[model samples]
Target: MLNYEGIAASKGYAIANAYKLVHPNLSFSTMKIGNPSKQVKRLNNAIKRAVNDLNKIEEVVITNMGSASSEIFKLQATFISSPNFINEVSSVIIDSKVNAETAVSEILERRISKLKNAGNGKFVLDKIKDIDDIRKRLLAYLLNKNMSDLALIQSPVIVVSEDLTPNDIIQLSNKNVKGVIADLGTNTSHSAILTKSLNIPSIFGLNNISKNVSNDDLIIVNGMSGEVIVNPSNELVKEYSLKITKYNQTEKPLDKLKKRNAFTKDGKKIGINANISSPKEVNLIKNYMIDGIGLYRTEYLYIDSYSLPTEDEQFNVYKNILSSMNNKPVVIRTLDIGGDKQVPYLDNNDSSERNPFLGNRSIRFSLSKTIIFRTQIRALLRASIYGNLSIMFPMISELNEWYKVKKIINEEKRKLDDGGIAYKNPKLGIMVEVPSVAIMADQFAKNVDFMSIGTNDLIQYVMAADRGNPTVAALDNPLNPALLRMLERVVNVANAYKMDISLCGEMACNRYALPILIGMGFKNLSMNINSTLDVKALLSLLDYSLMQKMSEEIIKNACTVKDVIKIEQRFIKI
Candidate 1:
């Protein structure tokens, strides 16, 4: 038996034969186009063929995985229509008189150049692997002239791959898919989140599972421990089965608390909110008495696309969430990209920086992509008609940036009015992530609807620690006194303005931070859906007034994580 360690993405246990997915060999060579007209025609023909293959893949996905998973084919379509991508490939293909695969390689090289210039060479390169895989599949389709057998399954499959794109992850049908293990992925990756949502076992960044493990090998995967047992004996399987049962049995109790309130023993109300990326998650809006969505990220619709989503597409997504809330407030935070999140369509060449977190990203990128920003505003405004929709601009530091956002929003409103589209005024807000913004929260509260503290970014920013960096992962402490003080300031300012204040970050989900947040006057606690009931139960068992009294000490003296935990333990006991 072989064992390896990786980050546990989704929790579960499973024993199944590994189904390893092999990627096609990628090749690239640049071509110089002598005739623009001829090159254009060739490029168009190639794209058409690629689209036809994607249609076949879509049909295959629908037949094999179900329609819900087939929505990912849209990503393949976007790749086919990439303007910079198409132009670059056409230039190389026509100039060099090479095969499409070689042309794609040259195009990839060009993308590497662009990525390097954008200052996130490694991040962009990782993302480009997905693009290249699509190109290779398209090449295979062209060579074979048939994708009919694409749905053929090899079953009782434990799907293993180097990684999974959001598009590929959906094509999985739970009927035959026992579990999934990958060589690369993060908690926020589409595959990881989807697996968690589906209650499947998943482990990521497991270095060499593909090379070490052969096909049809019986493997026992323990997601909680990030371990995969190769060729497990019957005894281990039986042991794991019991473990799974016990885990489920424990969780069976939390289900009943879903509908209940999160009021503490002293009757202090704790509002629960959910973090979301797509409008499809709107189904979760009324599952309980959720205060609202804390973070409705809009990046999913923009990233992996050749062109920005149409205004109608953006509006439909926003409107659905708005309509589903049924008078419940929804806070939609504008695009948060960079670090790991990237958009293929943006032609950013300034890649000289080291830390993308501190680079020209988030609101800075939003300002750069004016068309995208304007289109998003138009959709948010249209969706506002459905219910109470509050718009929050992310990564705000300087006050001037907020003014600029307000200016653009006003322009979008004017355009909507001119076009006779009905829209209610949305409560404008800002995400207090930067320390500067947190310190100046009182000033911002006067200009916006409410202040939503995004402690995840705030913690990273204040500590100068990259949360994704394993070397400094221990230093990524949201419990740091600096971050706590900022949260206190934000909550105080919001309360002074009679504005709603909430925390929607990884920190909000922390059992230790719960009392501190409640103590600091934060009414709403937005977190992952799975943790909602547990937090509610904990809240119901605690005394918020005591924590409120101790909030001052928690923020003033607590500099390390140990200090923060000690404070919470004492407050909770009281």
Candidate 2:
């Protein structure tokens, strides 16, 4: 038996035969085109067909995987129709006199090479897979060749691939595929996102997995532990089978706590809400027994569309989500696009910064394009009549940004009023993600109706470490004493002003962080849909008074994350 370790993306255990998916290398002879005009025409036709194919796939993905995952197809379709991409391919064919397939392959390779040479780092490296997927699909259409489809798998298998694109994962939905193991990918990759949404156990970043694993080899994919055992012994198989059964049994108890409130033994009720990207996810509220939505990521709407969504279109999506919530407070964050999450349609000249994270992003990007910002504000204002809605601005580092955003929102309200549009001004809030903002939390809390600490970015910026970078992942610790002190300050400011505050980052949902957060006086907590039930169950078993004492000791005595964790373990033992 051979054991391999990788990064665990989704949670589950699966034992099945391995099905190797090796992409065939296409060999083509370069031939001068007899007629450039005809070649260009053929290229255009191929692109059109690819766009049409992607559109069909988009609908299927939306129905099966939700709008967030469906965005991958929409993005690919946009790239296919992009004038820059089309013109580049046409130029290659006309200038080099090469066939459509060769021209596309050459141009895509050149573009990918340029992206790498520019030192764009991991973000651009991940995008290379998407471009490669497009190249394969287009070339297949031009070559009149058939590409392997996961939907055609005849039996249950653990899919082994060099890299599974978003489209590949989507096609595996409802198929006999039980798990996924890939040679290259990260937790933030699109393939990982799709697998999690589809509930398929997955592991990534296993180097040379495709070379070592053969077809029909019995494999055990332990996604929770990031372990892959190839041709396991009977003893190991039996052990894993028992572990799977126990894991499932443990999870079943969480369902019983779904109807129960998240209250400590001493009777302190903490609101447990969800963080969602689309309206389709609102259906999970009842199933998870969520109090409300803590964070409604509005960036996906912008990133997924070919153009900016019209006010009415945006209004309808927000209204549907709010109405479905049935009076539960839904905090709608305005378009947080920029930095790593860029939209081609919204691209301006200022996007070529060396460090996009510190450059124009979130509120800075929105304020620069007031027209786009106002349109979203108008939509949220129109949707406010449906349920309890709150507006939040991301990446607010100073007071002026908040004042400017509020001014524009008021201006949008006046425009609506003049047009006789019925709307209400929802509660306004700002995300305390920057250290500068956390330092001024007291002043900012008094101005905004509420505050939500985005611990993900907060820790990243506070520690000067990029969370996505593996080398610095350890530095971006939420349990770090410095981070704890920052949160302590923000919470104290919010409490001092009696403003409602909630922590809406990954930390809020983490079981280990729950006692510290509740002890710090965070009455509202929000996390991913899957974590809600377990967190609620954990909360029910804790005593708030004891957590408060531990929290005090943690903030006062602990000078490092390890010390804080040690304190938490001691409290848990009690």
Q: Rate the local accuracy (lDDT) of all candidates.
A: 0.72, 0.81
The candidate maximizing lDDT is 2
Which stretches in model 2 have alpha-carbon errors above 4 Å?
A: 1-9, 16-63, 66-136, 144-198, 202-219, 228-231, 348-351
Distance from true location, Cα of 391 in model 2, Å: 0.9
Residues 435-532 of candidate 2 have per-residue lDDT tens digits of 99999988898789999998878888999976544345557567888888889899998998989999987678667778898898899987777777
Candidate 1 deviant stretches above 4 angstroms: 1-5, 17-22, 28-69, 72-134, 140-164, 172-195, 203-221, 225-235, 284-286, 304-306, 348-353, 549-553, 571-574
- Candidate 1's residue-wise lDDT over 1-574, tens digit each? 7777766667778778887766544333444445555645655776787776566667766664445345556566776677866777777666676655566655765665664466432233234545555656655553444332223454666778777755455555434677888877644344676676556788877766778888789888888778888888789889988987898898789888877877888998778888876565676546766777777888777663434577798888888787788778788888777765666546442364577778888898889878777878888898888888889888988989989999999988898889999999888888888989887877887788777887777887888876554345546666677778877877887888899888877677666777787888888888767668768877887777787877878777777778878877765663
Q: What alpha-carbon RMSD in Å does predicted model 2 have with respect to the real structure?
A: 6.2
RMSD of each: 6.8, 6.2
Question: Which residue pairs show backbone clashes in model 2?
Answer: none
Provide TM-scores for the models: 0.78, 0.81
